[model samples]
Target: MRAAILQSSTGIDPLLSARNMVEAVERAAGEGADMLFTPEMSNLLDRDKARAAGSIVAEADDVVLAATREAAAKAGLWVHIGSLAVKADRGTAPYANRGFVIDDTGDIRARYDKIHLFDVDLPTGESWRESNSYVPGDRVVAVDTPWGRLGLSVCYDLRFPDLYFALSDAGATMLAIPAAFTVPTGRAHWHVLQRARAIESAAFVIAAAQVGHHADGRDTFGHSLVIDPWGDVLLDMGEETGLGYAEIDPAKIDEARGRIPVLAHRRALGAVEVAR
Candidate 1:
């Protein structure tokens, strides 16, 4: 399957972001791509809680999602919108970090709210308390597409192996890890983590990422990558934000799994025995 990865420098403005996404859809379609993938916080990425409120809206009312869906339908290209900040039930949390799978017909195939919220204080004097603003989701989402079973996940979720394992066990041949990573972490762990996830799951890993400086007063590590099941990097759009294309052959998943048979050998651990 032909795939297009969009590495964008998302800002605090949702309208500009929506326009960019629509243009990306059109360009990807014109380029003969079968599908288009975007980075996390495709609509709005702001560190400030109060300042972001103006653009954040319910999924039903989001202009970006609506525009992307319409663009996808018009282009006849499937789109994996990395993630968008949307209004959630106030009782639970003020918002949700959500991802979407829009089919060529402009229909929502699946929705995955980012379960693992990033709540940490980095050594760079940057602190994020995602849980303070967005409620974590409890569902694992995967959907059937022209490219095969696609598992959905957002940025911080890449660190967890259990999620990918479940997705692979659920017959997912491809994993989407869309992220807006900090410069420090991106420079250190991005490539290795992405490769490791693909290697273990024996599935293709597609990562579209936020790149460079943004209007939100933050810097992002911008090496968007695509890894094969064998852990080989196919396309790495480093720093530059635009449309990057890659070709995926579904047969590779079986090839890698056949070589390792890791999934078949997977076993649940009963207990940890204390050592003397």
Candidate 2:
């Protein structure tokens, strides 16, 4: 299967971003791509809390989601909407950062809310408190697709290896990590963490990323990448807003696992206490 990863800057306007994604979807479909992957917050990226709270709506009401679904149906291909900020229930944290997997018929196959919230104070004087606006999800999600069994995770989830291990154990052959990563952190840890996950799990890693400066005054590290199970970088979109394509060969997964067999070699570790 051929997959297309889109690295683009998303602003606060949902309709505009959706239009851009639709165009990209058409292009990818024309190029014979079976699946299209987008970055997190593909709908909107607003720095102002009040504006974001007021603008973001439920998935059903979101123009971006609706538009993307239509595009997928028209193209007759699968689309992994990396993540969208959607309004939550009345009592929840007002919103949820959610990922959606849409099939060829434009029906939603799976939905996963982001488990980890990015709450940090950066050395560059940039701070984000995602918990203030979005509720964290508890379940780890993986879905079956024509390409392979896919594991789902978002930006901050990339920092946690145990989650990937669990997914790999659950029979995920490929992992999707859609992100809107801050520039500083992305520069420091992005490639290393992604390669580590692929190498350890012997699974294909597809990471679609947000890039460049947005209207909200936030800059992201844009290096959307697709890595094979053997830790080979297939495609990397450097600091640019565009679409990149890569082939997904199931044979590679089998070959990588057969050579390493790391997952089969496991041992239980008893609890250890530290001596003063």
Candidate 3:
């Protein structure tokens, strides 16, 4: 199947932000993509800690979801939203950093709350405390589609290689790493991390990401990419407001695994060690 990965930018206006997403998806659909994936926080790129916390809401009533659902139905394609700020429960907070898979029929097949929270201080003096605003998910999730079993994950989860291995062991053929990676980290680690996962797990890796500056003056390192099981870059969206496409063959997963046999050759280490 053909897939499209969107490298999107944050806009000054929320509605316009949503429009950019719709237009990108539409363009991808017009190009005959069976599936289309958008980056994290596809709606607005508000980086102000206070505003992002207050503004991002996870709800079925979210405009971006509604529009994407409509677009998916109209385009007759499966649309995977990398991540969106969703309002979780009312009377408490605004939302969660969530992602969804909408089938061609406009039905939501799967939903995943970002399991790993981004909380850190960068050398750039940019501090992000994702835990302050959103609740983290407690489970690993995968969903079945016409293509194959798809593993779902968001940005910070990239650091945990074990998660990718687990997904592949569970029969996943493709993994999604949707992110709004900070420019520094993205430039330094994004491609290598993605390539490593594909190499280690023998699964196709699809990463859709944000590019350029957002509403709150935060910039994302955007190089949305699709890598094959053999660590080959099938398609790369290098710093642009566009989409990247690649044809995925699920059978390649078996081929890669059969050749490398990395999963079967593993020696297990017992227990986690405490750092003193």
Best by lDDT: 1
Give each model's whole-structure lDDT: 0.94, 0.93, 0.85
| 2 against 3, candidate with superior lDDT | 2
Span of ten consecutive residues with least summed lDDT in model 1: 88-97
Instruction: For each candidate, give its TM-score against the true structure.
Output: 0.98, 0.97, 0.93
List, residue by residue over 93-194, the lDDT tens digit for candidate 2.
889999999998899999999999999999999989999888998889999999889999999999998899999999999999999999999999999999
Q: What are the per-residue Cα lDDT tens digits for candidate 1 across 133-170?
A: 99998999999997799999999999999999999989
Off by over 4 Å in 3: 90-94, 266-268, 272-276
- lDDT by residue (tens digit), candidate 3, 1-276: 899988888654556767776787788889999999888888767766666555555566677888888878988889999988877763343467788999998899998888788999999999998887778877788999999989999999999988887788788889999999999998899999999999998889999998887667888899999999999999888888788899998778889989998878866689999999
RMSD of 2: 1.2
Kindly provide the TM-score of model 1 when superposed on the true structure, using C-alpha atoms: 0.98
The collision pairs in model 3 are 57-86, 57-87, 58-86, 58-87, 86-95, 87-95
The total of clashing pairs for model 1 equals 0
